[model samples]
Target: MLKFPNNFLWGAAASAPQTEGHSLLNGKSATIWDKWFEMNPEKFNNNQGPSDTSNTYEMYHEDVLDMKKIGMNSYRTSISWARLLPDGKTLNSEAIKFYRSYFQDMLDNDIKPIINLFHFDMPWWLMEKGGWENRESVDDFAFYAKTAFEQFGDLVHDWTTFNEPMVHVECGYLYGFHYPAIVDMKKAVQVGYHTLMAHVMATKAFRDSKVKGKIGIILNVLPAYSRSESSEDLKAKAASDLLNTRSFLDPAVLGKIPEELVDLLSENELLPEVEPSDQQNIKENTVDFIGINYYQPRRVQAPTNPKVPAKMPEDLYEPYDWPDKKINPYRGWEIYPKALYDISIMMRDDYKNIPWYVSENGMGVADEERFMNDDGMINDQYRIDFIKEHLEQLHKGIEAGSNCFGYHMWTFNDCWSWLNGYRNRYGFYRVDLNNHFKRTVKKSGLWFRELVENNGF
Candidate 1:
């Protein structure tokens, strides 16, 4: 058994867009997600949209009881900007009251509340205005962040300015994974820069506020692996690292952009429109901590076409091939536990001594309820072992002097995933979405209860 510090946080994580289902609240304007689902329902897996989610907006008190039952000492959730400010200008009173009461419930229940201002749910009005690509949307994000800090800062102690900014840039702009999907790399660069600026602004705002808490950003980081010792493969792996992780990480924690990225962007004429003041803000307003979400390791080989493209530097990495690999028996994600340790070591040594938490990590299994036995319980021993194996690597990272603060799984209860919808379950408690979404504790939930109480497996 590995020992953690006494004050270590043990909980689960969920995003507003994924968990909270009150999309059409009082005077609440639609987010990009709402608009996207409304426009194209076929984009998501199984054509399941984001209209009626887990309904956490209404059942949060019940959910908190579920958290308490599972022995969670901390809870991580995000605030939907559109929920608070429908028009991007006028604040919604009912929305504010709901979240205020939500935070107060967690604090009153002895659960430390971790709040994220933005979690990929960009307001539709802002998206129509070019989202993060336009400089004005940057100002709108700052307004949302400031508003959240001022209103919820009283009860929410830990603040995450943005959730996975790199993902937002890559998915929303570059790779077109999320709403208003665009493939232009220039827009991607601009959006990335604006997201960082928003984080910097939000961090400063939170610090200056009356709320007493820590401000950080959550990044989904995958350890990069080279296929071989060839210089091309190694360089390709480095390129993948620069684009995927270091782009936002360099500026947020180290307070500067990576030279490799800068050179690439400059050559392509896709450099972000950054003001001199933005640089100063990033340098001056570094985060107190960072939240890392790891699912798998990235394996890369040399690009077949070594020549750089006319516009964008061919970040050509040999494509990933996951054939006959070690698989998590009960889930869809490939098992690569070493990536967790490698990522933590990289953060502890390469970057500044920034404390980190496992903001989100869990295997998503199909038919979670099928594992439930006749004893009126779920016997998910595989899921239990999955969590234990990851925690072992996390424990090794901590023992090696990594400044890791906590570990939170992907979620407390089965909730809606973005593209995967409700097909996959990544929770200790399974929610029967078809039958009024009744929450049921799995064997993993009971195991996690003891794990939290013992602070180790």
Candidate 2:
């Protein structure tokens, strides 16, 4: 039977904009989400914007009680930059007070606070000022990082700089899923470079502040697999790897960009506008750790539409419809439990066993409440099985000497997912969207409680 280490942390994660209610509380201005919801409410499902979510900002004390009940030792959350700095220049005292209380409450409950700096919720003021497209925003983010370290560094130990940098690039750049959406590869490359630069700068800030905790960047790691043993499929898989994984992994961990990316960017003339100082900063200030979020794997073949004109390799596989590939029916992600083990081994071998953690990993389902049967709880046995299977593979990776330290699910409570909204539930505890955000323990939640209590399943 596979087992976990005694010190292995078991808990859940949440972001501010997704969980915290967007209210004009005590002179707090609206963020990008609040502005976006106001402009087009219909864009969200059930016309539900960020207004009516979990309200975690206000209910954090009660939420910690729930965490204690569930046997969580570490609770991961992000401090919203918009909430912290509404004007992008000054620190909001009211926001700082709330966060202070929030951190104190977590520690009071014996829950280690794993705080993240930014979780895709940029301030509306910054968005208006050209967002990450402008180099000034990067400097602004670095300042915000320093401010956070100064304020909460003592309480919060594990500091994650950015949540899923690849997702940020995909949503904010190539795809128009996120704010200030620009569909240009050149702009995406610039955003990617600047984001890495921001991470490096933030790490420097945390170190210079003499913070007693670890600083890392969260990356969504999906091990790319070839569709078949064919050479074209293998080549396509390698290219897809560069596009998705290596693009961020190389810069963050190795303090260098992959040669393939450099060649591709040069060929397409989409290389980032890197200043002399930018290169020096990136090389000097690499992260101390990496937080890997694994869900599934990517299988690819050669590009059928070579004329599509996007140098990024994900575009290359847009044309071919590969058969005999497995996928998750409940959610669109492909299920490859083996990919979890492969990803862990890859991180250990490729990155020289850098200290890493499974920051976010879970299955999402539509209408999870239906899984409830004669009992008054959402039975979610499948959710339990999903996690158990992943953990078994993770244990195998650990046996192979991977430097994984902890495992935190995608969320703590049911919060609003970007684009998908609340339709997909990934939380251990089910949150009723209708019942004033009432939290109920699912079967999986109970199972996790015991898992955490015993230190393993």
Candidate 3:
């Protein structure tokens, strides 16, 4: 049996780009995803792009009601920067009207709306101006943040500056999985550095503007593990953690970058240019809390042959494939519940016990329709089991005194994913693509209701 503390926030998460469709309609400018899908439909699976994801823009009243019916007290979602401001300078009135009604629906349903500012959907106008790589984009994001705070800060009290900024750095720049795919380590470094700078700048604006909510960043923290206890392997782990986890974690939480990481980048001559006041600003303004989105762990060993340039991740470490690892068969992700406990323990011990929550955690299954019951509900027992196992670990972490306040699944509706499109479903309610995008709650959703009502199971 497992149980959570009193007043736990039990809910789910979805992003605007992944949920709100009508890409070019209603004065919404194209995002990187919209443009990239337009240019390279072949890149997406089955040519299914995010033309009309869950139709939340039109269906949000019904969707938020569904959330309340499922017993959710909180729902985390992002505001589309491009949708809110077509040019990133002037605000869109229709967009503001839509968001006010949408957020008011959440409040009317007695649900706390946890709003996230960015979720990798960069505006095309901003991208053309060098996106996060250019220093000017930092101020642009801050302005967006200030505007968001001014408008919706009264209605929403929980705000995150960015969700998974590292994904933007690595996917868009290093791995080229995203739009404007540039595969340069120097560009990657610059983008990553500027992203944190933007985060800090936005955080400063939030405090200075006297927003209603406690502002924070949502990081997909990958707790790194060494392949072996060898010195080289541990060194590789340090490097990997420094690059991904600590880069944002330390700055957002501790108000500083890891000195070791700075030294490494400096020695490699890959350090991004910084202003004299950046460090002091970071030092003064740290997050009130953070959202941790943990899906997997990073296992690494020293690269067999480090590149002479040694700029990319592979140049420093080799990602290790654990032999005895359990994996999710549907999505091929490693299933490691213990890592949840490990992360919480590390947060308790290493990070001064900062307040945090499990921001995004769920299982993605392909061909979920096969599990549909005759009653039209998805028989997603596998998803239930997945969430239960993770919650068990979370319970242990909380019992051990980690200041985790909530548990939010990856999504509520089967929304559109960027790279894979909707190939795999990770939602409590199945959104039918063939049936006018009908929304139906799954078996896991019922379980979620009971779990939340009971404070656990």
Q: Using lDDT as the measure, which candidate wins?
A: 3
lDDT of 1 by residue, 50-100 (tens): 777888888999999889999999989998888899989898999888899
What lDDT would candidate 1 get against the real structure?
0.82
In model 3, how large is the Cα lDDT of residue 182? 88
Badly placed stretches (over 4 Å) of model 1 are 310-314, 322-324, 328-332
What is the C-alpha lDDT profile of model 2 across 1-457, one tens digit per residue? 4568868888898888788885456445677677877887777777777765788877888899888888889988898887787787777898889999999998999999989998888777878877777788778988999999999988888898998887778887887787656677778878888888888888888889897988888888777776677877776777778878888888788888889878866766777887777667767777778888888777777776564456554655542344755666767776667877998899889998998888988888898867787776888898888888889899899999998889998778888886668888988788887777889888888889989877776
Order candidates by lDDT, high to low. 3, 1, 2
Alpha-carbon runs more than 4 Å astray in model 3: none
TM-score of decoy 1: 0.95
lDDT of 3 by residue, 1-457 (tens): 5889888999999899999998899999999988998999999888888778889888899999999988999999999999888999899999999999999999999999999999999999999988988899999999999999988888989999999999988998888888888898988999999999999999999999976679889999968989999999998899899998999999999999999999878777788989999999999989999899988778899899897667788888899999999898867889998889988888888888999999999889899989988998999999899898899898899899899999999889998998788888999899998898899999999999999889989
The per-model lDDT (C-alpha) reads 0.82, 0.81, 0.91
Candidate with best TM-score: 3
Worst 10 contiguous positions by lDDT, candidate 1? 306-315
User: Local error of candidate 3 at 115, Å?
Assistant: 0.5
CA error at residue 362 for candidate 2, angstroms: 0.9
